[model samples]
Target: MASPVKLYVYDLSNGIARQMSLQLTGRQIDGIWHTSVVVFGKEIFYGQGISITNPGRSHHGRPLQIIDMGETALDEQTFTEYLHEIRQHYTADKYHLLDFNCNSFTNDCVGFLTGGSIPAWIKDLPTDFLSTPFGAALRPTIDAMYRRPTPGQIPAPSPRDPQSASSLLQSVANRAAGSSSTNGYLPTPAATPLQATASVASPLQLCTNPHTLNSLFRTHRAVTVFFTSQTCPPCKMVEPVFERLAEDKASEGVAFAKVDMGVGLGGEVARAWNVRVTPTFLFFLDGNKVHELKGVDAPELRTQVDLLIYQAFPPHPHTSLNLSSIRSISLDPILFPQVPAFQTAQSKLDGFIDASSSMDAKQKAKCKQTLASPVIPFLQSRFATKINPNIPQSRVHAVCSEWNKVTATLVDALPTAELFPIVDMWRLAILDEAVANWCATGSASGSSPIHMLLDKAVSAIASSDTTAVPRNFLLTTLRMLANGFSHVTLARTLIDGRSAATPNKTASTRQNLTSVLVATLLHTDAPVRTAAASVAFNVAAHCQKPLIDAQRNGRRGVSVKIDDAEGDWEVEMVSAVVEAIGRETQSEDVVHRLTASLAFILHLSPYYEVQLKPLLDVLQARVILLAKWKGGNGGLGEQGLSKKDVRRLVEEVARNLCP
Candidate 1:
């Protein structure tokens, strides 16, 4: 059976706490004291109010109640070490009378030991007192009496040194032996030893043995070894910076390790690596040394470490495809010119109302008003003209304002048939270079009238039920947005929003719009899938360019921060593209988009090769079969690509995986 953990409650004022509280708030309180966690008859406490001592008698009086806090998983020594780490941050010098006092320490210790917190009433007592009027008034006087001690008066406990494996094991053994003498409580049986794993959790692992160093290099895709010595001043200066870099790059499949040249096994490893300098950095890929840097240049060190990971996974060939070529492959907008069919439909509708058909007069009037409205003509004119980047900002605002009014009027009045045409017109408008440029340079506030109008129009149109609007209309709109996204400035404005940290209404709406587009790829329609793939491709291609360029230029990693959603957008887009390919493999347009998207993602970050390997393997096998069939005068498979293009794209991506 496991030993029960106990909470030792002590009254600091020796049971006169109610009188002290009455003076402060005119209310009797339970107690004004401190608390600690005691397990196996050892009294473990924190803060300046309580001293480290044996149980039964101490500066603070004996327990008012010894509440059992259930059993704990940690051994006594491990629990003590955990408390030591907490003490480094919550030292006596950093204590507060109310905010971070003795109670706070007890709460943290109890939670860590048994996975449960102390009673809420006790934990919240100080806060509750501070909330009251009289208690608040007496806070300052009370706080001054218990303020943290000045330096040299009561020295803070020193942090524990990083222990070696043997030393740590010995310490645990010593604690176990000492605990056997504790009163009444018996130590639990030793836990089964866990198998050693080469997963480094700290920002920097001090590798003192060849086995440990080898394990890290083998387990991780990329490892950076920092060779340093205790006597080297430069190494000390660069140590903190290197540790910070390790933390920043931890999620990027990079492992950081250090070896001290003055140490035993670390010295042997340093000699083997041919380290002539104290602050040498050796970057390893797949357990082999690939790059070496010597000296204490912090910026260069960060760049080289990032470069190591980048080199390990070189960009995909598709990522480097000419932007011009991608644009060429994209479908042109479905123009809605005033053709004979539209004219005939309008004439019939008018005649039907005039000849006293079943249609009501009011409905016919609405149809006539929608047809005669100058909105379509204005939209046509706007689409036809080349958007002048030199146009005054005010004039641009004026144009968008007029269009906003036109969209609102149409959305409120037009029936499904009438609205479909307007949606098509709006789709064409998004492709205009002038509109893209204007939106790119619009107000950073995200509250610009033009942006608001565009968001409202997109949400009103795209978010409507599928039965309410033509599916083709929604797909076409997505295609237009995808085409616009090819423009880097426009893509950034749409995806990242005005403020990267906090997304505004327009950004949130765009996120919703993007999610809708991604969801549409799962639809039964091939064309919808095709359009969604294009949107993903264009956005990924444009957004990933800067990150790829940064890596090429030997800069730190690039990140996208759009509201609460932060991560590698390149990876997300690649996955989405792969998913689309898996859903529908027969459409040529869809295949083209997926091919380009995969290439772009590979080009941007080759690290995703692990995640994309299965897809790549399937694609390669198909490409091989297709090439053999074409070469032997056989018919092409219905997998949506010509033999030549499929083979080339597949081969390009495969080249990046080569050693």
Candidate 2:
């Protein structure tokens, strides 16, 4: 159930700033604004860092005002997950008093929860204060008070530091009654124990204490430590090299840490590890000390680190191949961006609407009105212009509403065979982000007009035995689904049943978009098969992005994010693309696209070894792709790739499978 989200507004000055602000700053400021988002029985705020407390029970006491910020559709678990991701950006060290304080945090939360911001007064208070001469004069002093050390160049906040910002902020707001700091993170609600949030761990961690170092050892499979002292000149020389190597290995389930033997609890750690020397390196594999070295040797360091990575993640067999061509190939998705002429598409659609005896008089009138002013004009003006014409949001909303109404009515009135013209028009319109996001939201809830229409087309194909579904209908539907990937939200929806409207955990790819794309991969028509290949490529690209990003950032292993939400669809998609490629012999375009999609699905993918490799071997992907590459020997009937580039690509894919 959706719960009400409220903004708990507090006057940090306890009304003193309101009365004294005119004299102090020469401006009539109402109050020193501090805000917390109150939602799901938790009062969430960011000061030293993101903190959750029982509503209205934090040190701030009663709120000056509680503003209703409408209901949040995000369930507690999802919201908690969002908090986990967002907290990285709101760490205690990143906090600023005049900028990015409690109010900034609340603004982001309100925007996510309700698609609106915290009131202008609360959000604009910092700007209002900074505008006055007195405030401008105080900016430097305030900034200096909140300045943080350069990131990754210092030790973690020492537990012994009693004057932490969280305590200081609390004391200042509470009139200096007392001070307290207890790690800044309190227990979250029991109902949603999101202890494990999806966030990239910092490449370099400063180990000020044994506790932090132990935590790293517990969580990571491999941990690399650089032990140094302030007095060690060699430590300074090798610091940059260690940091760089840490960044390169960070994403490979390796945690890199640095400890200063002379500072805080670092002395205890050094003594415990029996490291009497400065600039020592210790490598731990699975919490056990595996190797130790004492030196500033860069080459040896690099060698040992590479050896550690190899032990952690064995290289894929495909990595041993000598295919320079495949490595050079771009993994970017092949998107269908050609927008068919809007007028002709609309004209074709209008004929269907006019001829539909099933469409009511009121429905026909609504469709015509929608097309004349908003829908057709919006598309023509938006796409025709070289420069983006700054169309107002009101007009965008009008187009979205009208498009939804007309499309929903048409889907109901027109038969599946006659739906191609309208579906084609939709394929073009969804290239716009706003319309695509709307359609994605509707798809998640099973209410979108485009979603409903695509379902009808898929149903027609399923019910038919032989080429009964119209070719145009299949082509248009596949193209529309391909265009759905133009926006990230819609792409995720099409790939894994995730949408902006709701988080449907039970959402699967066995049916819906995946089923349609898999079935149409071997469609009788070449154009339909090509279009299906495009859709399959988009899906592969979505799954491939994180893995590629990890590898590019110098991480090891293909990433399986949050345990692979699509379940068995990764195997299903690869199997379908391999089957489709084997049968496609007519169009070079089809083979090239199908080959690209297959390569993307297989490249740097975790599914390859455990699932896809066996499947590829069983299906004899090597033979099929090689047949395309080699062609019939000496004027045989076999049609081989005529394009050198396509043949090279096919050879590369085949070599990886059977090399």
Model 1 residue 403 lDDT?
Answer: 55
Give residue 523's lDDT in candidate 2 (0 to 100): 85
lDDT tens readout by residue for model 1, 402-427: 55454454444444344444445445
RMSD of model 2 against the true structure: 14.2
* RMSD list, candidates in order: 19.5, 14.2
lDDT by residue for model 2 (1-659), tens: 78999999887776766544543444556777778899988888876567777887777778889999999887998777667645554665555556546775777677667666777777668767865544654554454444423211222323532233234334343431111332246333323211111112234655655655775676566788999886899997887788777756655767777777765456778988998898999998878888898989988887878777787676655566666665666755566667677788778877888899998888888897788777877877777667777876557756787788777777778888788877877788888766775665555555666566666765786798426788898888889888877766566556545322224635343256777878888988888998998888777776677665555556573346324534367678877887887787677788788777777677776657777788888888888888878777421136678888988888888886542
The TM-score values for the models, in the order shown, are 0.40, 0.64
Clashing pairs in 2: none
Question: In model 1, which range of ten residues has the least summed lDDT?
Answer: 192-201
Cα misplacement distance, residue 525 of candidate 2 (Å) = 1.3
Please, what is the whole-model Cα lDDT of each candidate in the order they appear? Answer: 0.53, 0.69
Give the clash total for candidate 2.
0
Q: Compare the candidates by lDDT and give the number of the best one.
A: 2
